[model samples]
Target chain A: MSVLSLISGASIPVQLVMAILLLASLFSWYYIFLKVFTLRRAEKQTAEFERQFWSGADLTDLFQRAVNARDSAGSLERIFESGFREFTKHRREPGTDVGALMDSTRRAMRATYQREMDKLESSLSFLASVGSVSPYVGLLGTVWGIMNSFRGLANVGQATLSHVAPGIAEALIATAIGLFAAIPAVVAYNRFAGDVNRLAIRFDSFTEEFSNILQRQVH
Target chain B: MAAAAIHSRDEALAGGLALAMHVLFLVLLVFGVSWQHKQADTAVIVDLWRDLPSVTPPRVEPPPPPPEVKPEPPKPVPKVEAKPPPKPEPAPVVKPDIALKEKQDRERKLKEQQEAAEKKKLAAEKAREAELEKKKRAEAEALKQKQAAEAEAKRVAAEQQKARDALAAQQAAAQAKVVDEYKRQISAKIRRFIVLPPNVSDAAQVEFEITVLPGGEVLGAKLRRAANSTPAYDAAVERAILRAQPLPLPPDPALMRQFRELNLVFRPKD
Candidate 1:
């Protein structure tokens, strides 16, 4: 079947609406695939960084390099840089309170965490939009389809089940397509939200632990 | 504890990126709306006000302020005309049942005529084959005589009396006759073995699908559609098919080649 013709034959205004919905679905799905890869890559990098951090590397050397590599900063490396930079800067200031110094470092790290979270969350709202709106879009198409079906029935001499079947089939296809687009979107949005929350939790915990480390070292 | 905490961060980051991207994708998908083509709209309503002028609306009269005319006419009402009875519609011209019967008879005659023609053709062919066999035998005898004469000339010159040419001539003729007889026998056996279903009358027209093994035996038969079935008539046809199993295989390479698996349809009679 020619999908274009199938969609084109529907009511005019609805066809436009359906076209927009379909485009949104296509765009969302494409982004979904893209995000999956991007997230996977980010995860792999995070894992690699953590492994390196525990690989007997000197913390001071790691911190110095991370801080020095200011121009090109990875999210994880940036977070570390912010915390360590705050720590060194506080130590240098005369009579800086150790507890207060750690607090400044923690805030810097928290800011970096927010930035990273924003980057991670980018385009997530689009997914949310798609998840929420796709069904309504599909419903619009379906409503249009049903209207056309009724209009067609009005012209027919005798309306039998068979006579009405094709129109109904075409109409139902819109709702089905809408669900098809929406289900995956909703599921993906939920899953991604949960993952982002988990990651945020991890960032918060990391900041606390790093603050404790700074606390002991300075004190 | 610190290590455990750091590891959790790693896990969270990975999971977070995935969730964020997926959510974004879903949001974009839900809001996007392009499905129906704009060009398909065919709604139209035609107004009839412009088509025809009103017949009784040209002379508008104003109402009088007061009634001025006085009328007093006591007249008897005209008698109502007697109602005429509805004319009974002449009975619809019913053609004699002969038309249907004639058509049926014509079909039956045509079918019988076709069967007779087929039977006559088969008989004629069998007779022709017999004549050909007779001619073949005569030619074989003449060839044997010619060979015997040549052998006698060579035997006398070489002073060796040989029965070789005579024996070979007899064997050749015997083999030729045996082949011809075998073919004739096979044809007869085939004719006798086939029991075409009654419903599949020589007059019936239908396509059949029959699967067969290497053996001439019919493995299966089926009508691919109801259009092929002739009601309870198909029962008689099916019976004939079952009765005609294990068809006698012909020695003719051409016939045997196609005899393996085959389907054929007959109309009326062929």
Candidate 2:
């Protein structure tokens, strides 16, 4: 049998396995590109917001800009807005202490930080699962195919390489496709996960640094 | 909230990109497979039965007679078939109604002229009697023809069965003859190489099991039964067998099946 016939002639279970692996590969590539664009955008937005924050822009003006930019605002900008809004609301109270004001502001910023991180982290698990499990699915197809080929050998009077070559070839295609689907997924997952971690550290440091600024102003 | 909206747009974009990439990948996969397929598609046809240009003389005789006999019967069958239609068609035909109708018309005109009603009625009654007799005779003849056709069909069927049985027996005999012919040729070739030892007994026989390849090369020759004659005669026979390196074998694979492991009985006297 030829290469084309080998795939088309594969047993039903093997075909099913190949189909699942193909779909996994397709969706994983989709997420890989999507995450690439998204992570790049997040990193770019965080860098722009950080530059503007450290440029000594007025806090009230920055807060107003963040609110106006609402949907387009980056993770760091949103954390800054939530923290400034908390500080302003507590300052209106006549007897509110500096420690309590800073505490409430940090809390609001931390909450917004967590939500932004969640948004970035979405679908990363899907890539991880596909990367880790697709090889085994392909292995199942290979094992089944080899078993069927050997079983056919039992009926033949003379066992030859030609008898088993096609079946084994068809079975191996499963493993090849499995690796094909998994390598990119695993690679993309590691790259994106590392990028997201870097973003998280940046957001955490900004939250502590912004609290220090607000603490000095209140005192 | 704005992130979700932007995320949806990204999702749509990603979906479109994914679908396009998969389509491209599938096209590449199909093209690659079919490309590699060009070389693999060529088929090899092995010729199991090689035509023997030198061995044509013996095979020329047996096949012609059966073919000649088979073709001869069918050739003249259609051309000389003049018996069936004329014999059955002429006997059952009777035109009594036309003659009776004309007579009645003539009698009616005559009766009207002569005013004889009694004579016209009697003639009508006689015409009816004659028509009844003719119909009865036609029915009997038709029944006889149908019975004769049934008998002819049964005889033809019996003859066909006998012919089929004879053909099967002839095929079996032809196959046996081919096997015997190959065996004798192999024995003759080995005998030509024989340098017989003197003073061998008339009853001394040496039988060997000869195994041959498709190309008539002797793969092996083992002594199954040694000649009770002197050691020299036995050695001479074995030497002659080995000297006949490539034996004579039939070109047909079906005939070769019998010659694969041949039992050659070497009788010095005969």
Give lDDT tens digits, candidate 1, residues B24-126: 6546644554544579778997433332322222332333223322233323334333333334334344467767776676677667766766776676677
Show where candidate 2 strays beyond 4 Å: A1-3, B1-5, B33-270
In TM-score terms, candidate 1 sits at 0.43
Alpha-carbon interface RMSD of model 1? Answer: 9.4
For residues B57-145, could you state the per-residue lDDT of candidate 2 as single tens digits? 23322222211112111111122222221111122233687867766766676556454455555666676677667667667766776
Candidate 1 ranges with C-alpha deviation above 4 Å: A1-5, A68-73, B1-270
**Each model's TM-score, in the order given?**
0.43, 0.53
The 10-residue segment of model 2 chain B with minimum total lDDT is: B68-77
Cα RMSD to the true fold for all candidates: 39.8, 15.7
Predictions' DockQ, in order: 0.03, 0.29
| The TM-score obtained by chain A of candidate 2 when compared with the true chain A | 0.97
Question: iRMS for all predictions?
Answer: 9.4, 2.9
Q: State chain A's TM-score for model 1.
A: 0.88
